[model samples]
Target: MNQIITFGEVLMRISPRGNKKFIQSNNVEFYFGGTELNVGISIANFGGDVKHISCVSNDFIGDTAISYLRKFDVSTSAIVRSNRPLGVYFLEVGAVMRPSTISYNRSHSSFSEIQPEMVNWEKSLKKGKWFHWTGITPALCKGGKETLLEGLKLARKKGMQVSADPTYRSGLWKYGENPREVLSELVNYSTVFIGGVNEMNELLETDFSYSNEDFIEASKQLMLKYPSIEKVFDKIRTSINSSWHKIRARMWNGKDFKETLDIDITHIIDRIGTGDAFAAGIIHGLQKFDDYKTMEFGAAACAIKHTYLGDINYANEADVISILEGNTSGRLKR
Candidate 1:
C-alpha cells in the first residue's frame, strides 16, 4: 500500500494536572497534537506508512514536537521549518458532569503563516495513495486555506484518494473567511467525508436533526453537490458523565446507511483525541476492512482511546481488534 499523507497544524498541548481546574493547577502535562496529526499518528500506531506535512517553528519546541511523532513511526521529512513560533493549546481535563475545554494560543504560529508555494505538494502527494486534511487547517489563516486547497487540487489531479474530517473549531476561523463558505469549497474535493448531522448543519448552514433519517438525507445532499464524495461517516457519543461514555459509529456508503454496536466505556482516561482516533481508524479500515466493517474498527479505536491519558491513541491493531472481536474483557496476556 502507498503511504497516507496528512496536512495540518500541530500544537503543543498543555493540560492542567489530573482533573484540576486551570486556576488550581500549578503543574501540567505536555504533548503534541492536532486533528490531522492525531489521525496520522493513529495510522502509524496501526503499522501503516504515514507522513505528516506542515510547517513548524524553527526552534527547540517545534523540534521536540516532531521528535515525538518520530517515536510513533510517522515520517517528518516533509515538515518545513519557519521562524514563527509553534502553536499551543491549553486543555483542562474535566471530571464527572464537567466537559473538557481547550483554549488556543496559536496566532502567528508557523503553520498559520504557511503559504501555498512553501511546500512541494506535487512531490509529496503524488507518491501517496491517500491524502488527508482537516477543517482545522483552513481555519488557521487565509494562506493556510489556500495551501490546503492547492494540495487537494493537486492530489486529485494525481488520482490520490482524499479524505476530510471538517472539524468546526470556532476559535480558529478568525482569518476573514466565512467557515461555511471555506469548508464547502474544501470538502468538495474529498472522496470520503467524516462528520455528523450537527457538524453538517453547523458547517453547511443547514437545520438537520440528529436522527438517522436526517443524517442520511444530509449526506445524500452533500454527495449530490460534491459528486466526488462516495462515503460519509460520523460517530455518536452518549456520555453519562465525564468519565463514562458509549460511542457508536455510523456511515453512509453511497448506498446503505450502517451503524455499529455501541461500545460502552466505563472508565475514561482521556477524552481529548477520541474523535481523531475514530478518523484514523476509518482511514485505515477503508483500505483493509470492508465498507461497514470500517465503522466497527473506527468505533472500537475510539473506545480504546478513552483508556489512555495522552492526546494520541496508543492502541495497536491487536488492541483495537480485541474490542472489535468482542473481547473487551481487559484480561492480561501471559
Candidate 2:
C-alpha cells in the first residue's frame, strides 16, 4: 500500500444551517474545509496512510483545524504555523434550480504566503507512493505556484504517482496573469486528472457538447496532450432544485472510458465537499481495484457525502462499501 500525501490550505467555512442567506440567518454553522484536506480526511478514514502538508495560522482557527485533522487520523506534522490569521468563506446554498453562491475572504492567508523553503520537499517526498494537490493551491500566490511545482518535481523524481484536481475557482485565481496558463503547466505533472466539464472546457480552450461521449472524447484528447496523465475523471450533475440533485460520474482510464448512471438525491443535508469525496473514492478505488467498478465505488462515496453536514470527514469505509454493494435504499444496519 502506498501512502498518500496531500498539500493545500484549509479554510474555516461558515454557512447557514438551512437555506438561509448570511443576512437572513442569526448564526451560521462552521466547518473546516479545503480541497486537498477534504480528500486527505476521506482517504484517511478509509484506511489509507494519509499526510496533509500545508501552512496554518497560530490562532484558534488553526488549532481547530489541527484537531479536526487529527480526529480523522490525518498526519499533520508537515503543517507549519505562521502569525497570519486563518482564511474564511461564507456560503449560501441555493434551492430549486438556484446556484450556490460563495464569498471568499482569504487574501494573505497563511497558506497563500507559503514559500518553497518552508517545505523540505526532498524529505516529504520520500517514502510516499502518491501525492495529491489541486489548482487552488497554485492560484493562491506566486510563491504557491513555486511550492506546488517543487512538490511535483520531487514527487516525479521519487517515482510517486501524482493526482491533481483542476478545481478552477475563478475568484482565487484572479490575481494571476491567467488561470489557464498556470493550470496548464501544473497539469503536466499530473498522472491522474480530475475536474468538472466546465473547468475542462475552460482550461483546455475547447467547448465540448453536453454528451457524455463528447466529454469523454475531449478528456481522451487531453490525455494524449499530456501523456503523463493516465486517467481523466469528471462528475456530471443535474439539479432539480436546491434540495434535490441528480449526479453521475465518469472516468477515462487510458484505454477506455466508463460512466455511472445518474442518481436522484433528495433532501441533501450539505452540498459542500462532495466533489472531494468523489476524488477520494476514485483514489481509493484506483489503488485497491482494477475494474471499471472503481467508478461505482467513487460515485457511491460522493452520494454518501450529500447526507453529511460537513466536508467528507463523517463518512467511513463501511458506509461506502455498503453503497457499492448495492444497498442504496438507505436502510439502517445492525
Candidate 3:
C-alpha cells in the first residue's frame, strides 16, 4: 500500500480522570489528537502506511507529540516546528444523561500560524496514494486555509485520491471566511465525500431533512454540483445518552445505496474521535472491499472507539474483523 497523507492541527487533550468534571479533579490526564491526526493514527494502527503533516511548537511538548505519533507508526517527516505553543483543548467527559463538553484554546497555536510557503506540497505528496483533510484546518486562519488549499490542488493534479470530511463547527469559523464558500471550493477537488446530509446542507445552503430518501437526494445533488466526488459515506450516531449509543452507516456510490446494521455501544469510555475512526475505516476498507462492506467496516471501527480512552482508535484490523464476525461479547482472549 502507498502512503496515506493527512493534513491538520495537532492538539493536546486535557481531561479529568474518569467522568469527573474540572472542579472535581485537581489533576488531569492528557493525550495527543486532532481531527485529521486521529484518522491518520487510526489508519496506521490498522496497518496502513500513513503520514501526518502539521506544525507544532518548537518545545518539549511538540517533541513528545511527535514521539506519540511515532509510537503509533505514523510518519511525521513533514511535521514542522514553530515558536508558537501547541494547541490545547479541555475535555470534560460525561456520564449517562450528561453530555461531554469541550473548550479549545488554539487561536495563536503553531498549526494555526502555518503558512503555504512552509511546506512543499509537491515533495510531501510525492509518494502518497490518498490524501485526507477536515474543515477544522481551514477554519483556523487565513494562512491555514491557504496552506491546505495548496496541498489539495497539488493532490488533485497528481491524481491522488482525496477524502474530504467537512466537519463544520460554527464556533471555529471566526476567521472571516465564508464556511460554505470555502468548503464548496475545497470539496470540489475531492474524490470521496466523508460526510452526510447535514454537512451537505451546510455546503449547499439548502434545507434537507434527515431521512433515508432525503440522504440519497442530497447525495445526488452534491455529486451533481461537484462531479469529482465518486462516492459518499456517512456514519450515523443515535445517542441514547452520554454513555450509550448506536453506530450505523449508509453509502451511495452513484449506482447503489446501502446501509449497515447498528453496532450498539454501551458504557462508552470516550466518543470524541469515533467519527475519525469511521473515516479511517472507510479509507482502509475501500482499498480491499466493495462499497457496502466498506460502510459496514466503518461502523464497526466507530463502535470500537467507544471502548478506548483516547482520541485515536487503537483497534487493529483483526479487532475490527472480530467485530465484523459478530463477536460483541467482551470475553478474555486468553
Candidate 4:
C-alpha cells in the first residue's frame, strides 16, 4: 500500500469553447489543469491514496480549483494560500500542419513564490512510497527550483520512489537558465523518467533517430547516465491532422523495453492532458501489476483521453481496460 504525492502548480486554463479563435470568442471555457495536479487527480479517481501539494492564490479561481480537487477526493491540506494570483494559460488548438499554441500568464504566480520552509517535507512525505513531479515545476523560477530540490531531497532521504516527466515547454523556462542545465539536475533524482525523444535530445545534447530499438537504446543510455532512474516510459504519436492521429507507447523496465500496437484515433475532442493521462496510467499499472502488459493499459488510457474534453479526471479504468482488450469500434452504451 504505497501512497503517491505530486508537487506542482495548478492553473486555470481558458480555452475557446468551440473552434472559434481567441479574438472571435467573447467567452472561454474554464478548466483546472496542471501537469502534476492532473496526474494526481486521475490517480485519486482510480482509487489511489494520492495527495497534491502546491501553492494557490486566495482568489475565486483558486477556490474553484480546490473545489474541483475535492470533487475527485484529492487531499488539499498541504496547499499554501497566498494573495498572489493563480497562473493562467490560453490554448488555441490548431489544424493541419499548424500546431497548438499556448500563451501562459504565470509570472508571479503563488506557486512560483513557494519557499522550502512552506512545505512540511517530513509530514507530507511520511509513509509515502512514490513522489511525482515534472520539468515544468523546476522551470518556474528560482524559488520553484529550490522548492522542488528540497522535495526530492526529502523523498530520497525517506527512501520513497520518485517519478518525473520532463515535459519541456520552451516558453516556461525564463529564469536565465537553459532547460538542459535545470532539467538534467532535477532528472538526476528521478527513479522513473518519462518524456519525448525531442525533449530528451534537447536535454542530453544528442541527436537520436526515431525507431523502437533506437528509442529503447537511448533510454538505456540515459538510465546509465543517471543511476537513480530505473524505468523509462514514452508515448509515440503520429498526427494526421487536428482531429485524427495514431498513437502508441513504449516502456523500459530496467532490463528490457516493450511497446504497444498503434491505435488509430478518428476524432479528437481535446488533445490536451493526454500525456498526463498516459503517465497516470503508467503509475497505476506499475503500482498494481507486475507485467509488461501495463504498457498497453497506459497507451489505451491515453487514447481514451483524446476522445474527451478537459483534463484527466474524465478518464475511467473501465474505458481503458476496454480499449486494452481491443475494442476500438467505440460502440455506444445504453
- How much does each candidate deviate from the true structure in C-alpha RMSD? 1.3, 1.7, 0.8, 1.6
Cα lDDT, model 2, residue 114: 91
1-334 in candidate 3: lDDT tens per residue? Answer: 2899999999999999989999999999999999999999999999999999999999999999999999999999999999999999999998899889999999999998799999988889989999999999988888888999999999989989999999898888887989889989999899999998989999888888879899999999999999999999999989899999999999999989999988889889899999999999999999889898889899999999989998999999999989977899999998
lDDT of 3 at 245: 95
Global lDDT of each candidate: 0.89, 0.84, 0.93, 0.84
lDDT of 2 by residue, 290-333 (tens): 63767887888888889998776477888888877777788777
**Could you say which candidate leads in TM-score?**
3
Worst 10 residues of 4 by lDDT: 288-297
TM-scores across all candidates? 0.97, 0.95, 0.99, 0.95
Question: Could you tell me which residue pairs clash in candidate 3?
Answer: none
Which residue pairs in model 1 clash with each other? none
Q: Report the Cα lDDT for residue 1, model 2.
A: 33
Candidate with more favorable, higher TM-score: 1 or 4: 1
Ranked by TM-score from best down, the candidates are: 3, 1, 4, 2
User: Which 10 residues in a row give candidate 3 its minimum summed lDDT?
Assistant: 203-212
Clashes of 4: 0
- In candidate 2, which residue pairs get closer than 3 Å at backbone N, Cα or C atoms, i.e. clash? 95-242, 96-241, 96-242
Runs in model 1 deviating more than 4 A are: none
